[model samples]
Target: MDGALEKSISFILFIIIGIILKKKISSGDETNGLKSLILTLALPATIFIALLKVKVDGNLVLYPILALGFNVILFAFTPFLIKFIGIDENSAKDRSARLLIPSLAPGLSCFPFILEFLGDDALAKTAMADLGNKFFVLFLLYLVALKWHYKNADFEANSLKSKLKSLFKTLIYEPVNMFIIVALILVSFGITIDKLPNFLSITLNRLSFIMTPLVLIFIGLAVKIKKQQFYQIFSLLILRASFTLFLIVGIILFVDITIKKDILIMIAFTLSSASFWPFAHISAVHFKEKRENTKEKTFDPNFALSILALSLPISVLLILGILTAGNTFTEINSILFLGTLLFLIGIIFPIINKIKKFLSKTTKEIKPITKKKKIQLIADK
Candidate 1:
């Protein structure tokens, strides 16, 4: 099989396996815990190891800065876009989720592709850049977005501080961060493993292989939709896609960024759509909202999942389209094209609802209101 075809097939197989597991499995604390383990531990270690092995150059600074700038721009514009799209004022959590989703590309999915297509050094640089993007989205963007939504509430400050603290603790105490720091130190000191001990290296590689599948499975497991929430979800999706396209095109025009084939691959990865983090944030916000006796609104999980799923296939095709579209589609064109596809997919929630049903069998259970639910809810107060 051809290389691209092979990768595509692998991705499809991964998704299929995920769907099967998700159908048979329940989203209980155990599954959630496993997801956390993969995100906070296995994924980060793989990234750090990959980065540590690669050679760095000036692009190291450039890529991360670009990633951060891209995220900042998205966050700034998402609110206005949300307003223009006419999502209810009470749907701040959903709005934030919408904004944050585009900011979070599937980092794990793109990493291996980066390593393969861009070589070790570019992968290292992209890894650092990705770390910056992750930090900005997870810490800065999320906190501020949450604050904006919860602004009028009496306990907002305390709630914000507590959430920040939790984020901080998670960042600091996570094994991945520690490993990354250690790896960086070793690299800075010009220490090379030359050959990593076979057992250690093998273990790391095994864990790394599991990371992508685990993430995709978690996403598959999280897929959900509601007939009632389709319009709101559709509106938010459109806004996100538009903003993402604007950023991608604007960056290409203003910046002297070269469009290396590797960058093309990275753009494909970055442009593929949002990830599960936004859904997690939505859940957090909903938990807070419930505490304030706000109207109970169900979050459309399929909104983000659909956006992500459609993004992958569409982006791959878009990249191919741009590459083949004569000389007119420059690197900038590729970015804009991919960004626009994401935007379009973002708006098509009805399509997503249809896709979601085909992908997963276990619908999310809407639980009755309880003290636990109240403590966890965070929407319209």
Candidate 2:
């Protein structure tokens, strides 16, 4: 087998192992423990090494801007799709969908795969892209969620300065962000991974080594989706991913992405799973609603949970499948075909439900009358 196919098999096997081990893993806490290790240690080290390995130039500035722009587009597009899907406007579920669909969580979902498949340089580019996403998720979306809270309840938001200050602190203090900043600073000077002390380099590389396996296992163990909202969530995620592909296709047509690896990076990075931060924002609002003793909520916790639970696995499948395909999806026609296929896939269930409803209604309208019933009616007359 080719190298790509072989690597893809290994990744799938690791995930399967995790799923098998899920039977032995008793609690959410264990999954959380593994996640903590990845986010705090392995992921950061991986990003640090990736960034150090690459040459960070001026064009790198556009990455975050592009990422943030994609978020805004998805945010704007979500409501129309939600309404078209027959959800009630401004309802808890609608609000939750709006917040979660647009946000990208590359740390857990995309980074490891990028490193393994696209190499360190591509991973570095994706890491830079996450900075803008972090800002959007941490600050802008937080404000939106807070506004939602204040709209429904009697609460006050702090001054912009205070909120910005706190958010700035939160951004800097995060392990991933810290590693990114440090790596960028080192790169700004004349330092590369090779220039680093041998001991530190060895340790970081070792930590990075465990990231891919740990992440895949966590995905297998952690994905807890209920059947209640499966179709809705699955359909929404499909539409979300389809829209993402179309958007990328538009860009590829206009922009100059020559390298297959670069094109894969664009596809994989933009298609990262929905961020957990939005759900955190949703939970914060839920907490305040509880404290205020309010009957109504700003966002549906269960809906948000459903989105988060299913997003990673779906995105993992997508990113893995796309990246593994190598040059198959590098052209415009292939991408358009894939996106169209996903769009159709997303709409098929809803269409089937509508058809079922229509058939039922028509059957009810045309009730068949038997000869005995007709004779009985004539006799009564």
Candidate 3:
């Protein structure tokens, strides 16, 4: 068996263990601690070390540009797409879609697979691409959430300014952002991981190694689906998956694939799970609204939770299919077909309902005429 596949299996088993542990133990605040560890310590260490270790190339520059470009295009269309799909503006579902659609979680979903399957080169490219995604999630999406959050309610100008300032401070002071800055400074000076002090290198390496298992376990613990939300959440996920698949196909058809590694890196990046940043933003919104006693709520914590829970498995499955199928059009074509079908279904759902109602009315009208004819026949006899 392939080493990558073996590692994938092992990672999944650890996730299963996490899920089982969640069942037996009262998670309470421990889940938050795990998430903090992954986000503030583990993931940053991993990304910092990876960036320093990888030899910088021209492709590195192109990768981030492509990643940022993809995000911008998707974000530009998201509001229109949400409106077209009948999601109300400034609503919970709308807010959730806005957050989930543009952001990508390459660190949690794509990085592991890229490292194991495509080797360090591909992983490096993905890490760079994630820089763009990280920016969108941390900065752009926060602004978006804040913008829509204030749309349905009123706030003082001073209050808004204060909130924005606090958000900026939070972003700048974040551990991840700090590490990114450090990595950039090192890159500017042409310093590589090899030149790092041995003690510091070892510490970062040890911290980085915990990232995957901790994140996977966090995902397991976070998974939850209420019976009522199943259909609604599933429909949203299908819509998201369909659109993402469409984007991937567009890239394949138009983008030059001169370098196979670049294409694979692109595919891995594209298939990444939804970022957890959305959940954080939504929870913040909820907390703020509650404190302000706002009756009109635009953010839905449940929707954010559902997306976070389900996106990983969906992303993993898609990435696995791509890797296993040797990145052929056959699997991609299959995804396109499913995506197209889902799109059509979403478009025509109301029409289907109207037609069903019309047919039921016609059947009911015909049944009355048949009864009247039978009565007339009996009277004539």
Per-candidate TM equals 0.65, 0.70, 0.75
* Candidate 1 lowest-lDDT run of ten: 361-370
TM-score computed on alpha carbons, candidate 2: 0.70
Ranking by TM-score: 3, 2, 1
Q: Which stretches of candidate 1 lie over 4 Å from their true place?
A: 90-92, 95-99, 106-131, 138-171, 175-198, 227-242, 255-270, 276-311, 324-328, 331-381
Give each prediction's root-mean-square deviation over alpha carbons: 11.7, 5.8, 5.5
- Total clashing pairs for each candidate: 15, 0, 0
User: Candidate 1 local accuracy as lDDT?
Assistant: 0.58
Best by TM-score: 3
Model 1 residue 177 distance off true place after TM-score fit, in angstroms = 4.2
- 1-381 per-residue lDDT for model 3 (tens digits): 766566657766777877888876566678867777776798789778866875646757777778888888878877776665556786777888788877898766777778876788677778777777777886678777877776666666447777678667756776776887899799889998889999999999999898778866776776576764555455555566667668877776786445656666776687677887666666666767888798878787656766666777767776776776665633556657856976765556434445877999999999999999999999999
lDDT of each: 0.58, 0.80, 0.73
Q: Tens digits of per-residue lDDT for model 2 on 1-381?
A: 645345555765777788789889964678657766876798779878977886546878899899999899889999987876667898999999999999998876788778877888897789878877877886689788877766765435556676567556656776777898998899899799999999999999999999878866765666556664688788889988999999999888788777888888889988888886686577656865787688888898667867876787788888878877878888889899999999999997678777987999887766655556888899999
Candidate 2 weakest lDDT stretch, 10 residues: 2-11
> Please, what's the RMSD in Å of model 3?
5.5
Q: Give the alpha carbon lDDT tens digit for every residue of 194-256 in model 1.
A: 556778777777887787677666666655545554465455655564565565556566665
